[model samples]
Target: MPASATKSLRVAVLADSDTRWKWGALTAQRLAPAGAGIRLDGYLLRGRATPTARQLQEVGVHADSLREVTGVEFLRAMTEESYDILVLALVGGGVQAMLHGLRHAWGTEKRPVVVTGYVGVVYEKLADGLLLRHGADLVLANSAHDADRFRAVYEGVGAEASAVTEVALPFLGGAPYEGEHDPSAEQGRRPYTVVFAAQPSVPDNRKDRAYLLDRLIGHARRHPEREVLLKLRSKPGEHTTHIEELPYQKLVQGQDPPANFRLVYGHMGEVLDRTDLLVTVSSTAALEALHRRVPTAVLTDLGVRELLGNHHFTGSGCLASWDQLDAGHRPVADEEWVARQGVAADGSYVTAFDAARARITELLDRPGPLPPLTPYYTPETAPGYLPGILARHHLGPDGAPLPGAPAADKAPGAVRQIVRRAARGAYRHGVQRVAPVIRRMGEL
Candidate 1:
């Protein structure tokens, strides 16, 4: 197959949340050959972290068709429809379950090239997550450092390491930052803006979150001339890729915020347009900011523990504290570290996906039926662990749909649909409203 060949490719992305959906959709476009037509379809996995309509809108990606589906329902769709590619934008267990189900469903038959990878930094579950995703046709590593780590993990376990392909983060393109505070700019200077990118569950506790919020408010008070924005992932009662038990939105209810401080929610890239300094504990938005040449900080205020995920940025030279930031200290990123982490600050991002594109083209151009999907963990290899993961998705060890799995595939009637919506709303209400009250009562 020629690199310039034009083919209309049908790509289906099964995403569990908004962040993953954005990553998957953009990656589908990036993986396709240049000038090729793409018909993208989306399947949102129904779960606690399933994205709300507003969350999907905030993602700002367009799919030709989009709908929510259960694990079994998605498996059925794969069996019935034909697609050139299937991107599993899911967790490790979800990806593993789908691999087994698809293997059984398409036995000896031609199937789409299945792809899966992490949405951002792989801070935890290094071995467990990689093994669960081992059967994927291409397990994309978003940086050179990750690719090396992935291959090392695979070979350490005596598994094939060829499927790990190096690629840059797909959602990393925006206008380069032009030194927003440059005094000699032709246009009038904009306000010096500091954006704190908030994650859902990094701090994961009320005390740490409130402390960070206070620091942000203090920063606003100290620099009244500057604009401080708390860039939140999702609103109250809405879930993103991770669950937010103690959202900053709720924490700021009674506190008095300075006029310069405010909470803003929109596309991260758009917010970065006027941002002078971007800060986070461990959010992937820091990478986005760095890619666009914006000064980024990964805070070490709480600690550099793995729980905070700030340890992943240890070598990036972007680690700093709120005290340092308040002192007008901007840490320069290490060029060598940035290159290894695949930030693409040097404009190498244009060709980052070339290898992935070529690999997909070769797979699509292959003659005859392709080989069966063989995952690293089999019934023999992981008798105790693999079955539980499959059972959660309504599949047996052999990937056959277990009894009553078809019930999940059935479309709900109008009344049942309404009831389902109400149930989800109640669940969110419990998480946001009731749970906090109960916790406080317990403390008292």
Candidate 2:
């Protein structure tokens, strides 16, 4: 039997009509296996979804088609359902639409949304996503980078969010990420090798990855003795399915210069262990490589600017881009660094899992009816009733707007260019959004 209901503490997982929405929902459901008595609802807003209310089939499992609701209407439902928790999945444009939809779904009846997404350079996205999170009771992040970004956005919006996780290694029953593989399988095999994880989502985004892989193949070809074991990660949904129908090991050897790249599709724990030098575009597998003491490097792209920011050591040279893929570019990560990644045999993701559990529990226990988050976002000085509107409410004191922790910058326009590029990327990848503001001087 299901757990007792706690006055309909519904968790509405919004699936904004993007494949990303499906991906995010699957991810969250996998991560948060313990909803306890809290009800879980999955609402997908396809073009013709019906907005009819049906009995939640399973106590915490609800699947519905949100008929014809814009992002705003969807958000407003928080007030309608009195949702205790609103979990926003990372479907690029879904957020802006949802916020616009919920223009009036406030008062004590609304639910808090734990909005999450990648926090790269999407300034407005980071801004808007944070604003909603600020409005919602909590925000969960997939990575530390995201957590910190949300923190800034929330603080900017006059709210605070509990840090979720830097890397979301999931647990089934509140269990640690023991990673479904055994050491005996790895201990009896391969002398030295390297595995790389590749996830190609957006078409253009994968170009850089293809280029890097090509370069690696070239480097490997030039040196035959230094066996470079390449493990390709290409599972649909789990990662990007760029090579959708490409048969596993089908891309292995004799295709062309870069054509002979290795491939593995079903799953990837043992492959990760066998890897010597983990390489990729921007997949989080490098961290796994690090934990495994496998030296790592990005194919050198602006996307990887976050991790490959600087040199690890003067002569160590653990990080590099395609431009620096010299046959001599091999860098070694010591046992200590790999241990942190859970690589040196004793390393497991258990600690991080425990920490994540604690965080979720704390968020669940926090008092509801959080202060309104309007005053911190908008600035004072040249606004009419706005300042008064923000202050008259129970909102907290104003602090500096959490100007999104810029990716990297010491000057002007650089961050803007990056953030704006990201915003454009979000739009380009089929993300629906409220129309951009038109700034011009035209005839009336």
Candidate 3:
């Protein structure tokens, strides 16, 4: 039975710097049918990969609205506050922190249900899939394919198979955002625009990005009537880690771009509307463009099996050799494939949401403590190990306290502001550089 109307369920979403806004908004809506009987709080994790205040602002979420919690604070929040569930929005990666934090926080006491959602369909080898499956109470999948993979991973490791739940990729849930730039509505008045959605730092994909951009630029130059746009992962000067990759900004700096060539930076949902044709190595944007009925192509020039396992689009019929696209062939979508992938804008995708809601309701009725950590990590020593890990990373409750020292009181005025900034910078640096090595050491 659902919690009584008099007592609302307290749900906290554990979001990283990059995902807080979307998850924050989605969790509030997804749980709305439960009405005023639920309160959703977005807590930004600030241990290793902390999201900068500026990054959160760009996501349109006010920094103040989110509760910034370190591992220590997170543990404290779980015990002190009456949260019923903690949605681990960092499922694919960074989930290890949440698992460790949970063990440290709850110790022998019951912990809130830990749920996680999938980000996409592409299978990047999850080193800790079993660990995550063991730790997470329920892992919401994006599709049947994802659910199967998730299930196989856990079942392969002799963990519980019932933990996987098929949920539509959160973005696909609810109503689609109707953007202003509809290609069909504009028709002859607007130039035919080809947009290439950029991918992250996959070395093989990054190496050929410049070549791809040049192809599009060359095509635009030859056909001056058409326009070509490179939709960047982030605009230059944005506090994004796209710098980890070869940024397109640097790639296009000295090149002579034609008048028809432009760089676009916006939500892919909006950009796809203006886009008559979309090209990408293997981006989730391909899924979006296909759903929008926009012509889309998955580039396989470098080598399909070698570069990216974009075989997820195999049925889409939009895969093209770079030479084919260079010859001005507009790739066509395979309706059969679209339906199979559930990217079709029809009501069919909603079934995933139905299953998700059903699973969530079931969990709400039977909430209890998390399982022993020994099943996933160093259960026997997690509590002891966690404090030292937190201290090493300067992730003490009040702010990175010096090792073995108590947290200092917040300094007054300018001193406080300066101190916080320096600490945050150090946190980001440690997460980017030191955390990985330390984590690997722990595994060893």
Candidate 4:
């Protein structure tokens, strides 16, 4: 087949870190062969506060294709460039920020289809509802439960219900044997292996990190034949801080973990490959583990409904506590609950690659009416904010501003990079340290 004969599908995936990258990669892979002439190219749109494209290199995300353009540049590209679709691989304020820019650049006549939706398991819908009601042409619902909720909510809110696409968990289903445990593998050699999927940012984990670590350590100590692994969200020196996630390493720093337990990082697939049992408070990783037929237990040690956010798993018959684990209680998988949640018998998601392909093809074949611009960003705000965005990026309708002087052309590049890094580091340090003191001082 001649390359030129194929129809090209150019996609811009705006991502800040690994969470969105996972979805972007999945979407790109699935849409790669939607039609006979379909040719797909996925580009990473990165900016300030985002994990650098280099950090995602290990996951086969190439740095070469990453565009470190500002919000203004993104708007200009969407308005002027030729692209089939643009996916905002983000949620909450991060998404609102881009929608603000898009409001200014969007035109009623010609533009690429804009898409975004909830990227995580929906514990609550209030915050997600606001974003989904924003101007996405296609809003992907991660599960049947979510899809139904999206339709009802959007319809009630006077937004288009047709925009919602019911899809399986994008992280699962497409990849075969992705998280299957392999006892014969070198890393899986332990008699029984357990992986604690940590979500450091979750309030329950942050408040009870020590208790959680102690519980895991005790489990390892009691079952000397078993090895327990703390599967960290990020590695020791890597930057996967998508939304300011606290790495679990900081929690276990001064204490000694048992010999049977250790910390590991990399792809979830590699980590889950050796996992016989999976434990977490309310991590979405439970879905991944369950999909692999690896028994999963949702820890209810710290107020299951109030603090842990594992309330959804309660009816699923996957709930356990540190006390329960200590008493040798392991949760049995409940098929009835699983069916209600729309999870398949083999644990594969209902939304397979074929379904994903069909959905993408359908959206591409029929680009819908342009979404309203001022849903999230008011017309008044765009006027004031758009210029600031342009000035920050040194961009204009013409292009990047011309050099003022010969010295300006030289531009101390390394110094700028160093200063930017220092500023970000200081800001993060302040949030971690000063914020607590300020709050305490206010209370006093």
Structural similarity to truth (TM-score) of each candidate: 0.96, 0.52, 0.78, 0.80
Per-residue error for 269 in candidate 3, Å, reads 1.5
Instruction: Assess candidate 3 and give its TM-score to the true structure.
Output: 0.78
Off by over 4 Å in 2: 1-10, 15-84, 91-93, 99-103, 110-133, 141-193, 199-213, 220-260, 264-274, 291-293, 301-317, 321-330, 333-444
* Candidate 2, position 438, lDDT: 23
Candidate 2 vs 4: which has more lDDT: 4
Per-residue lDDT tens digits for candidate 4, residues 23-63, read: 76565544443444333334444443455444565455432
Q: What's model 1's TM-score?
A: 0.96
lDDT of 2: 0.42
Model 1 agreement with the true structure over 10-62: per-residue lDDT tens digits:
99999998999999999998888877888999999988788988989999999
For residues 1-444, could you state the per-residue lDDT of candidate 3 as single tens digits? Answer: 365223566677776545434554464345432443666777765533345654555445332236666544555566677666667765433465556556655677866667765555544565354454356666666566677777787777666768677665555432343433444675545777888877645333334767876777787787787778888765433334223335577678899988989887655666766677788877777877777677888887666653465766776789896578767787878877776565756667645466655555665566565454433434343455444444443444222334544222332368765876687567655644566468668979
Cα deviation at 136, candidate 4, in Å, is: 1.1
Candidate 1 Cα errors over 4 Å, as ranges: 1-4, 182-189, 406-411, 433-444
Please identify model 3 stretches exceeding 4 Å from their true place: 4-8, 19-28, 31-38, 47-49, 52-64, 91-93, 108-110, 173-188, 203-207, 237-243, 340-344, 367-375, 378-444
Put the candidates in lDDT order, highest first: 1, 4, 3, 2
Poorest stretch of ten by lDDT in candidate 1 = 1-10
Q: Which model scores highest in lDDT?
A: 1
How far residue 431's Cα lies from its native spot in candidate 3, in Å, is 12
Candidate 3 local distance difference test against the native: 0.61
